[model samples]
Structure formats: C-alpha cells, structure tokens
Target: MTIAALQTVPQQIETAAIAQVRPKILMVDDRWENLLATEKVLKPLKADIFKAASGNEALSLVLRHRFAIVLLDVQMPEMDGFETATLMQEHESMTGVPIIFVTALSKEEKYASRAAEIGAVDYIFKPINPDILKSKVKVYLDLYVQREQIMRLNATLSQSNEELERFAYICSHDMQEPVRMMNAFAGLLAENAEEAIDEDGRRYLSFILDNARRMQKMINDILTFSRVGREEILLEPVDCEAILRETLSEFEGVIQDSGAEVTYTPLPCVETSSTLVRVLFQNLIGNALKFQNGSQPPLIAVMAEKQGRYWRFSVKDNGIGIENGFRGRIFTIFQRLHRKEDYPGTGIGLSTCRKFIRLCGGEIDFTSAPGQGSTFHFTLPSGEAARPTRSGQQAC
Candidate 1:
C-alpha cells in the first residue's frame, strides 16, 4: 500500500520560508557630493544603499536597519569616524558590521592609520576607484547573505525537529488508551467465561492479552523517546553518584532476581540534564542484567573519572556481551539481538540512551565481545562549564 502521510510530512514541517531580501549597505560622510558619488558607483550592485550625512545619523540608521557594511568618512564635522566607530562598538548589533573608511589621497595619512586602529576593515582612498570599491563591498555583502541563509536554515531545522517530536508524542499518547482498554476487556472476558469457554479459547485470550500488553509497552517507550526531544536541556551541576543510586533503586526487583552486584565510586558533579542522566543510567544498568550470560550473577560497576574539561563515565558489566556484527546497528530503533520469548524488550532502550546523551551535548558508546561482557561509556561537561549552583556546592 502507498502511504501519503510520510511523503507530505516533510513539506508540512518546511512551512516556514527563507526570504531572499536585498543586502543593505550604510554610507556616512560630511559632504553630499561624496555620498552622491558613492551611491552612483554602488547603484549597479542592486543593494539598499542607505546614506547618512553625519556619524550620529549613521548610528541612528544602524539602530533601525541591519547593515551588511558601513562606509564611513574619516573627517566628519561633529562626530569623527573614530568616535563613531567607538560608539558603534557599544551597540552590540553594530559590532560585526565591516567598516570601510573612506579617505581622500589629499588628506593626512595619519587618519587612515587611526581608522585601522579603530577597527575599520579596509581603507578606500579618496578619488575612490569605483570598480575596486564595488568588488570589496561585494565580498562583505556576499558573506552577510550567506550568514543570513545559515541562520534561516537553522531556524527551520529546529522547528521541524520540534514538530516531529510532538507528532510522535501525540501518536503514542492516543494509541495508549485503546490498547489499555483492549488488555482490560480481554482480562475480564477470560475471568468471567472461564467455566463456559474451552481450553483453546483460554489460550487464545491469553495470547491476545500478552500481545496487547507488549504493544502498550512499545507505545510507552515511544512516548519516553519523543518526550526527551521536546523538553528543554537543563544544564546544571548534577551529582552522578546520587543519580546512579536513584537509577539502581528503580531496578531493585530485577537486581535482586538476577543477583547483580552493583558497585560505584564518588561520581563528581557535572553539567547535564538531571532527567536524561537518570534515563541513561537506568537503560545501561537494566541492559546489563537483562542480557546476562549463562546463570551467573551480573557484575556491574559505574565510575566517573575527570578527563580535562569533561568527565568520562563508564558502566562496565559482566554479561552476555554484544556481538561485533551487531555493534553498529545496536543503537538503532527497533533493532534487537534476541527474540521476545528469550529476552523481552521494545528495542528502544539503547537508542533512547544515545538520544539522551546527545541532547546533553555528550556522546555514548560501548565496547564488547560475545561472552566477554560489555562496557558502556559516555562523557559530559564538568561542573566548571556550568553556572555554579548554591545547592550543588562541592558536597558528598
């Protein structure tokens, strides 16, 4: 069957358009004749050439319009070019605008040198060569256009990502209520009709109920995965040792059943999302116990060691190690190594763990050999990278 929704989703996400507006150039000079001549030379370039008679006028114009480049005359009556440049530095928006100082060959050469010291990009001698001026200004204008395009593309991409995440969240949420109802109704039928229904009927109902529960779990996993992308990344100092302990508490039943021996050291505080941190630890620890080798108890150790600007964390486990062939695809969505009957899972744990680490500006990877066990590793920025919190003071 041909699906149309997937094909149209991308187009819908790209609803925001990027505008190709003309580049804006600001010209400041004391004499109208100079401004008029410069405007005539730049006319062929097809830009919005804005002329300012004084340095104060130029500053006011920049406040209203984002200029690609500023053409400033060194010798202005009230506010000289040097003072104007200094004042523009105060206005944050004018900082990046390339300034080309216009100096006549007849003027004092020291003004040119002074303009250079004042952060002017280039000096164009008076009796300005029209061709040279156009070409040089064109270079800056082209660069400005390219930078604007990048900003537009980034905005569009960020919006698209948010939309897709919201879509997944809505689908998973809507899918849950019906699946829960199915499981509940199936259970009721099985209980009330136990005497009337045959053994085969009971088995069929059990199969339906089991499959429904699995579907519910898969939907929940999808919700969890999508939720991370929607939530803002809160980078604050988080004590990894505390988070590890909390994560282990969640898997208490499984840890006891598997006779797992979990050990960890004083994991230092780091800049990270507290929620995703817990998810990362939970998945890694749960995977260790779930994929145990033979009947032997699982041995898991969590550690965090400082690595210059960031902290390198590792969860080493003695369990059924990953096969080399499956390493690359192990973190992919819905990709699993074992069957549902053997090792039950929605195949989203590793993928979600990777997503969580990425959102926190960190990376997660692992090393394993079949029967040799696996070691999952990741790195997060140290607390020094984040704003200091009073509660996160260097405490235990």
Candidate 2:
C-alpha cells in the first residue's frame, strides 16, 4: 500500500506537519545586550528564539510556549536562575526542558555544583566561547528535536496498533456466528441424512463439521488475544493462591481423568490485574496437563518466590518437553509441533500467556528437556512483598 493510504485509517496524519515546525529557544538574562549577543551566536541554528529580560518573563514565556532549551542568567534581580529552575521543575510540561546557567559570577566548584543540583544542564562563565556555546546548545537542540520526532512516531505507531487490534477483534467476532451456523448445519445433516447418504458422504460431512468447529475455536482464540491487547489494566491486590485454586478447579475433571498430580506452595498477593493473572495461570496449567508425557501421569507444581520489587512464579510439569530448535518458535501463535489428532490446540495459548505477562510489565520463559519435562517461569511487579496467608504445600 502507498504511504498516504497507510496513514488514512484509524487517525489523521499529523506527524509530517508538526515535524516541520522549528524548535523554540528561550534566552533569559537581566541585560538585553547579553540576550542579543547569545541570539546572534545561535542564529545559524535557525531556531525560533524568544528573549526574556528577567526570570519572571522567562517563566511566563515558558508557560505559553514549548522551548527546546533555556539559557538562564545565574545572577538576576528579584529571582535568580536557580529559583527559576526549581520552579520550572514543579511544572509537569517543563520537566524535559533543559536549562543552562549563564553567569559572570565566580567559577567556584560550589556554584557549579549548586547549579547542577538545581537541574541546570550546564553552567557557563562570562566571555562565553561562541563555538563552545553554540556546540553545547546544538547538542541539546538536536536531542530535543529527536525526542519530539520519537514521541510523534510512537503516537502514530500506537494509533496504528490500536486500529489493527480493533479490526482483528471485529473480524474474529463477526466470523464466529457464521462458523457456528456451519457447524450446526453440518451436524444436522449428519444426523438427518446418515440413512440416505453413502459412507463417503457421511465422512465428508464429518470433516466439514470438524473443520467448522475448529475454525470457530480459532476465531474465539483470536478474539481472546485481541481483548488482552485492548483491555485497560487496572492493578489491584490479587491473591495468587486464590487465582491458582480457581484455575485448578476449572481443570478438576481433566486432572482426575488424566491422573495428574497438581501441587502448589502458598502463593502471595501481588499488585496486578486479577483477570490477567488468572489467564496466565489457566494457560500454563492447561498446557502442563495437555502436553503430558505418553502414558505418564502429569506431575505439576506451582511455586512463587519474592525477588526485589518482583514476584517470581514458576509452573513446572513433568510432560513431553519442548525440543531445542523449536523453542525459538514455541510461543509463536498457531505454531504447532504436533498433529491435531495428537495435541489438540490452536497454538494461541503460549503466545497469549506471553502477551499477558508482558502487559503486566513481567517476563515469561521456560526451560525443558526433550522427553523429561518443562518449567515455565514468569515475574510480576510486586509493590510490596505480600505476606503469605498460609504456608505448606497444597495438592489436588
């Protein structure tokens, strides 16, 4: 597609127009001659320069305009550069704006240190070298421009991502109804026409019904993945043990029929989205049970440990483990290593688990042997180490 067409969907294109605007510069000094001299040195840079005769004027100008850099005179009447810088830091918008202290005062280490402490990017004495001043200002100016470009690009990229997710969600949701209808009709035909049709026809109808059901499941999985991306994450104190218990309960029948031995230590409460955490546990535990070693009962364990500022959780299972080469694409969506008859899944589970972990500012990975087992580990942000409500291992 053409670049223009790419930008047409989701939102209007504003980056190109905004990037063309010149970076603004604010020169603040008690004397107009100093401001004029500084402005002259910086003329080659071709920036929109604003002159302020005093700290008050500079603050006022900054409030009205976004400046790439501010050159403040250290010694100003009524309000000094240090005071102005401190005040500027208080304003959210001015947080990223860099300031340089221009002073004719003593070049004492203490003065420079004080300027540094007050958040001045640089401190310069009188008789400023035009080359050095211009070079330093140029560095900050280039950085400012690059920062703005990045911000704009990120905004554009985010808009595009949101649009794509919405489209996927809509498509997956809309496709489900037709797939369900197809499955239902195929089932009805199989039941009503079995006596009238040949064996080949019956087999063909079964294939159609099977495929329709599979397609519906795939669409449902896609919708689940899309919802993970679109949902707003609200962090709250969620009991890990409680979520795990609920997840295991959902698999109670499978655990019993497969002779799976599930156990977990006392998990702690973490600050994260409860729904997302539950999804994480559900996918991991389901994989543990589904991928059990041939004729070997599944032995699964869930455990958690407190790491600095994070809670590390591991779901270890004795199952048919991942191979060395396939590990790279193991988490890829729809990437199947086994036949549909052997392992029934859409291959969206692990990818979805990765997405959920990352959405919570966490990391997820696994280690496994080809035939032995696999252990999936992930970490979530823990605001404070939560005290476990109980101790000892619980098994089901």
Candidate 3:
C-alpha cells in the first residue's frame, strides 16, 4: 500500500520474468553417456545444458553464447582440459567464465595445483557425486545470475545519467537565446531612450538587464557542469606548474587590480586531463583573489605534496574565510554564502571544481574560519611515475 512498495511492483514482475529465462551451462566430455548423466542430474536446476565431445567444440560454443559455467573433462582427443581452459582464458569475452575440471585421473595434489595454475575454479574426480555436483553447479549458477543482474542495473543507470545530462544541456542551450534577447533589448532601451524614459523606468530596465545577464551566466555554468565527464577523456603527462601559470595569466588583470600576492612551489607532472585540472585551479585561485577583507590585500599560496599515489594540492588564501554554518553549502551548485551585492558570483565555481576533481579521480574539500581565510585542498592520482623536480618557490 505504501508508495515505495507500489513503485517496486513492476520491477519485481520484470525480474521474475528474467529469472524464468534459463541460464546456459556447457558440459565438455569425450563420452556422451557422462554428458547425458550430468545433464539429467542438472535438470532440476532448469538450465539450458549444451554438451561438447571435444575441447575445440567447447571453445566454439563458448564464442557463440554467454554461458553461466563450463564443466570440462580432463582427458580429451587432441586438446585436454588444462589446455582448453588456458585457451578460453586468452579470449577477451571468456575471461571471467568459471571453469570446473571433471577428471578421472589420480588423486594427486599436483593435478589440483596444475588445474588451479591453468585457471580452473574446481577439480572434481571421476564418478561425480549427484548431490555434490548439483550443489557446486548451483552456487556458480546463482553467482552468474547475480552478476548478470548487476551488469544490467549498471547499464540502465549509465543510460539514465546520459539522458539526464543531455536534457540539462538542451534546456540550458535553448534558454540562452531568450536571455540574450532580453539583455540586448534592455541595454538598447536604456542607451537610446534615456531622456524619454523616467528615472524609475531606467532603474527597472537596469534591473532587467542585470537579471538577464545573471541568468545567462547560470545557464552557461550549468552547461559546463553537465559536460564535465560526458565525453571520453585521454590522460597524458601534464605539468601542474604550467597549468597554474596559464590559469593565473587569465586572471592577470584581477590580480593586479586587487594587489593580491600569489606564490607557489614547483608542482609535479601528473597524468590527467589538462582541461579539467586547469578549471579546478582557475576556480580555486580566482576565489582566493575574489574573497578578500577590506583591510588588507589578499595573500594566496599554492602548494603540492606527494601522498602515497596521490598529489595533495592546497590553495591557501588570506581573504575572508567561510563561516561554519555556510561550509556545507559552499560546494553545492547555485548555493551562495553571501548576497549577490557582496560577492558577484553564480555559486557554480566550487561545485565545478568538485566535479572536475572527482572526474579526474580525486576529491575536493576546504578548511575555513570566518574573516581569517580558507584553504582548499584536493588530491590527484599521481601517474605511474610522477616526475617531480626540485622544489623551489616563486612569487607573482
């Protein structure tokens, strides 16, 4: 009767239908009687059993269908079970397929060890026990079913995420044109008919233009956020120092005008997406410069230290820090701690930083005290070999 239970009814029915479809199991034996006897034993499990008289036939059948498990015989004509299992493992699609070797050979520890070395999940002696065989086969069958369900769920979730991103991109793209028109027309009215319009009308037009501009910015930010991990990103060796210098160059005017002092140590060369890391640094450094106390100029320090397989980078500033209450909302999209008049931002910078950091296999967080300043820290996966140079300091 509850809403949550009601919503799951359809999914439960669909799962029951999926469960009704029999799982495929392959049995490889030189003897038809053995295969037939095993098939009879597994009948209660309701599996679609396929018999292979040779290893070659088993390999061929494996290529054609996705099997739940393969029961292989040790002694075959040309190719035996060990060789067959090794060959099957070489194929990309047959990598995780559980192979159980059924042999009538001597009960030596070496044979079992050899079977294990060749990727056999279990070794069963000749004259298979009906109950034991059924139990072992059922365990693998249940595992295969669970794995299939997980794969389907992951695929469905991925498709849903792609659709949501596409929706956000399209919605934001369509909204830009109307906002552009509003801003342009309002600007033109204020410029061309300033004398004809009253003071109140001019003020109203200004408000419209300002709001339109803000809306346009918000739309653009949304588009950028949606596109963060949408496409395939190639990882290459990117010099972190070079990325920082380029980001700072873009904010040259702001740094000069604010009289903010910036310094950084030599950064390591990490293997990651250049574009994403640059966005992260740009946002963090830009925020450091933007949020400042009126009494003193901003002092920003960018430093990096190697921690295990990650490079922990910190951006510390001597600007107005975040209050304890607003810390939780600081990294949320469109969540601002201050009024628009105080700090002119769409509140997407830190969120974008978080997104980009996560996309590059990292995390972002900050330590702040109100009126003292904040230090934003993030980690990046160091490449297989992070080429770090001599550490020295540079001021700008």
Which prediction has the highest TM-score against the true structure?
A: 2
Could you estimate the TM-score for every candidate? Answer: 0.75, 0.79, 0.73
Q: For candidate 1, which ten residues in a row score worst on lDDT?
A: 387-396
Candidate 3, residue 278: the lDDT equals 88
Any idea what lDDT model 2 has? 0.85
> How do the residues 171-198 of candidate 1 rate in per-residue lDDT, one tens digit apiece?
8899999999999999999989988889
Candidates in order: C-alpha RMSD to true structure: 5.3, 4.5, 6.0
lDDT of 3 at 244: 95
Q: How much does candidate 3 score in TM-score? A: 0.73
Task: Please give the TM-score that candidate 2 achieves against the real structure.
Answer: 0.79
Where in model 1 is the C-alpha error above 4 Å?
1-9, 12-19, 105-113, 191-203, 229-274, 291-299, 318-344, 354-362, 368-373, 380-395
Model 2: per-residue Cα lDDT over 1-396, one tens digit each: 334655585344454325654789899899999999999999999589999998888888878888898898989999998998888777777887899999999988999999988888899999999999999999998888778877777778777767767877888988988898899989899888899989899888988988898888789888988898677888888888898999999999999999999999878787788887888898899989999755788999999887878889999998989898898788888899898888888989788888877988999999998788999999998865344444532211
Q: Candidate 3, residues 137-214: lDDT per residue as tens digits?
A: 999988888777776666655655566668778889989999999999999998899999998998998899889999
- What is the Å distance of residue 279 in model 1 from its true position? 1.5
Model 1: how far residue 195 lies from native, Å: 5.9
